[model samples]
Target: MKMIIATLAAVVLMTTSTVAFAEQFEVINTEGSSVPGCQVTNSCFIPHTLTISVGDEVIWKNADVATHTVTSGTQRGGPDGVFNVSPFFPEDAFSHIFDEPGEYPYYCLVHPWMKGLVIVQDAMADDDNAETTPPPDDGDQKSQMDEQRATPTYDAEHFVTTWIISTPGESIIIPTGELTGTYSVDWGDGTITTEAGNAIHEYDDAGNYTVQVYGDFTSIRLGGDPTNAVKLHSIDQWGMIQWTTMESAFRGASNMVYGATDVPDLSNVTDMSHMFAHAHSFNGDISTWDVSSITDMSSMFASATSFNQPLESWNISSVTAANGMFRGASLFNQPIDSWNTSSFMDTSFMFLDAVSFNQPLDSWDVSSVTEMSYMFTHATSFNQPLDSWDVSSVISTSSMFWFAESFNQPLDSWDVSSVIDMERMFESAHSFDQDLSEWHIIPDGT
Candidate 1:
């Protein structure tokens, strides 16, 4: 009985030791280490590599002043799942548990060059089996992994296409399987006279269609004036182009000439928001556009990388929504003080990732904005007069200036009395210094 009891005691000690050993994976940043390779000084993990076992958790503690993220693998790196830890603040820690056996690599979406790999090994697999499997083929594995991570690809041809419209009162059938074509309109009865042409095409078909009104620039008349003037009076009578097909139509005739100077005529356009949001090569001047009827300007130029038209002259006094309006527009740098955004609520990423904008927005009224999280994040050089703006209504300022490297303006005038989460608000802002002595923090006694 005594021998059996001693054996059981020994087994309990061994089990405890194993449990403690299993939870031993830890990630640390080396002090004063700025080297750019694996095992930089005291840091165990580099940009894209970490090794651990099943049931083990890896904790990432930010030691440097610069913010870092652990986003899923991108184009340069390998497969990384949806788990992301971004804008990690100094002393802030994030832990992820590895339950399965696989190699997971991640990168910093904000800083793409930073990479890290997490290898989860099976507790039961022998060391010999692990060594013999050979590191997964980087070429084939990357392709397969990318396929799994691919977002739905949109076909432009399926939505927008060309067509021909016959005169004032004729039903035109669109050619089958043709995604696009030119539509020529000729006054059928001649009573309307092809010389005094002002005909509209009605596309009852459900898909996106690029309707091109072909006419002599010197032949058409609007008010009996012999000027090649085109007018789309109403939204109902005007052609409707959905977002899905807009890309294809824009690309097909992306370089097509329209106006007198080969410019596209958008003077009568009421809703200009989201018109060219995802258009890659839509580099036309719509500075004189009448956008007085537009209310939502959200995501209007979100990812338009090459658009640099001067739209400061546009009449956007009626625009109420500017959410994500300039999210990823890296080239546009025109003044937008003409916009009337009194009704905006969510300005979360209004200028996030916009690297070239450095204008003064101190005169605008942002009293109604609630979410300012990441509003100016990654806007490298956007440091100017924003001191007059009201931030009393803001709630989430979590990542408001996470990676704004060149933002060093004084924000003492901001009323953050209503803000809740201030975590990582100034993280990775390599050049940020604002006095927060006036900010109303919750009383320590209360």
Candidate 2:
């Protein structure tokens, strides 16, 4: 009888020990348990409070149907970078071992009202481990606040001083100020020249010819042989041209700045996108100004019917898009082989109907481009070497080579792995006969 009692006592003791050691909980998205402020709909966590010892592991099994995150902080404040466990799917379990004794307040990221707390108590208080330096200063640390409320520098109220001077019969464009780099001038008459101080030219007839300058000059004025005809043209109404300082100040003056002979200070401009988009008469020397801060160059020279200038010295690394940039610009064909196009993403409709752009772009880094639809459509004179371009990231090639009658380069070396939409890609491309049997086409274009 005594032996039987001992065996029964041993079994009961073993069951109690197993229950005490295993600290487990479940997170449920159900009605709250009768706690004071915890409600049914908002109380995401099943048991909102838990107590555990140091060196003990806690397992949280998600019983909710939706995903939940065990982030550390209150709903009003942001995350505290503590133990953040997220994406706990239905029936998924997450475990974490407590190494220190402290009160850890946690809340769900998705459901902020579903708050919980884990109170960890030391198994044994060691005096030597308790005495340490003070915690870090919260005030000294950098706050991870949103930066959208910062002060803006570029307001539309400020006006940039610009003047227009036209020379009726003079055929000479002279560089006056202390010129540093080499200045290139496109004489609008299909003639390009490089000079230091004074650039002289002879026009075949007396017609309005826009001369483009490509050098650095500050505080210089342009005049037409001491004639009143070289006065400031109409300043026009200040429209949506928002800028802090105009680098290409008169870029918005379409075709009017063509008569101006002086170059403005373009050293402080940041946004040069669409600056000379429709400036049909502006063939000035702007090749020497600093353009490092310029971000958007989308359609900078689009529809400029008579612009064919050399832009090889330009550093376009900071530009992000060139969409419809040179579209309908019939006379632009200069050597832009040295331009850095690594940052451009959207080149869609960039060279649409540009019939005279056939420069060699074999060395341009177009690896980041994702859209090339309508890029070379209607560009009849583009037959340069583009076989070595890395087109793995391009998604849409629809109507890319449409109506390109002069493009016959072998594109067998390009990686067209990521292209999804290729509808009408080579339609009307009478000159494209290269074999494309190795292209990996996606089934559903999503």
Candidate 3:
């Protein structure tokens, strides 16, 4: 009995390690979990089964109205003692790292009908084979720094984001994250630190210096704080760090930051809300970014005055909340009609004060949108067709087209019966004269 108990304890032990090349995956606990039909179709968790690498992390966002638990083990087998999130409310999130290689099943305590499985495979097996490979000639081989820059950084080997700081008294502060892993920071001024908890490293003299950070991280938020964002000169190398959220990463960065322009591995990122808010003068080459995994892009480029990059290739199929995505971007006028918004629900303040945005968005799938309050307020140059929208799921359209001077599109074919708030929906000096007498308001609407 003692040996059996010890074996069970070992299986549930938490082993945390940072890997640079690991990926991030997200699983939604889907809406309407309080009912019984979700289990019949195996749709409690979207993509009921997920497979990931050992070092990869799985973030679970609770979309159901009721609070649910993501406890390891089935309702019949009881708790396996692997991991458990007691009670997470609607819109809350819980994440777990799969350090061991095996199949781990998790179920909801509140609702036994909900179940999901995760298969973790060891990603280090390929690294062993890479060691047996022959090396290149001396002339063809690059330096250690060059090799690090040319490849993705991860915990499997070792690499970090190489930052170039040229100003004296300038500091870089590192923020804390959810998971605990070993982090090393090389200040490049003979100071090497292993702790990455709100680490504020200051340069005493003005000179070109390289700062490298190696480790596993999930959230590197407001990387350079709002007050010290100007001090951040450049991120010479953005290593392959499996980040889950980049929200407010550069909240108030100035134009001096000329890096972070490379196409990063963003397969696991979910929340990008306020990522580049107030980042004036930032016009980088990020036209090829894969944005398929992003769910929250609220205020992503808000107040970014000089950003006009081509973003027609971004896969935004998974986005759900895009509130204020391009708000106050005075000079941005990119064509993004080909993007997918089938999963979008909340797009409030999406284009508020975006004066130069006049593109074709007739092909967008906004049938899933709910709250469109202030979506196009002050967007003076927008004129498009939105007559085929299925607005039966929307509850609020307050100030939706307020102050949009050039919009005179036909929206008479919309179903406004579900909208409870339509105050000032088209209130402005606008040319909108469409007949809305056929539209019916909800019972509780004004």
Error of 3 at 224 (Å): 8.5
Query: If the candidates were sorted by their lDDT against the true structure, best first, what order would they fall in?
Result: 3, 2, 1
Pick out the ten consecutive residues of candidate 2 with the lowest summed lDDT: 1-10
Which regions of candidate 2 are displaced past 4 Å?
1-254, 257-268
Tens digit of per-residue lDDT, candidate 2, span 384-405: 8898899989998899999999
Off by over 4 Å in 3: 1-170, 442-446
Q: Per-prediction TM-score, please?
A: 0.44, 0.46, 0.61
Candidate numbers sorted by TM-score from highest down: 3, 2, 1
Report the C-alpha lDDT of model 1 over 41-103, residue by residue, as the tens digit: 324243336767875666665665554445444422221333544334445565555646887
> Considering every candidate listed, which one attains the maximal lDDT?
3
- For this target, which candidate reaches the highest TM-score against the unseen true structure? 3
Error at 266, model 3, angstroms = 1.9
User: Can you write out model 3's per-residue Cα lDDT over 1-446, one digit (the tens) per residue?
Assistant: 00100111112211222244557788988999778889888899976899999868787888888866676776544455576554456776656656679999988755778999999988765664665533444324323313322422334322233333445676777665554266777777899888745567888865444566667655566634676664444444566666677888777765323344355667888888887788764556577788888989999999876567788898889899999999998767889988888998998999899998998888888899999999989999988888877888898999999999999987878998889988999999378888888888766674
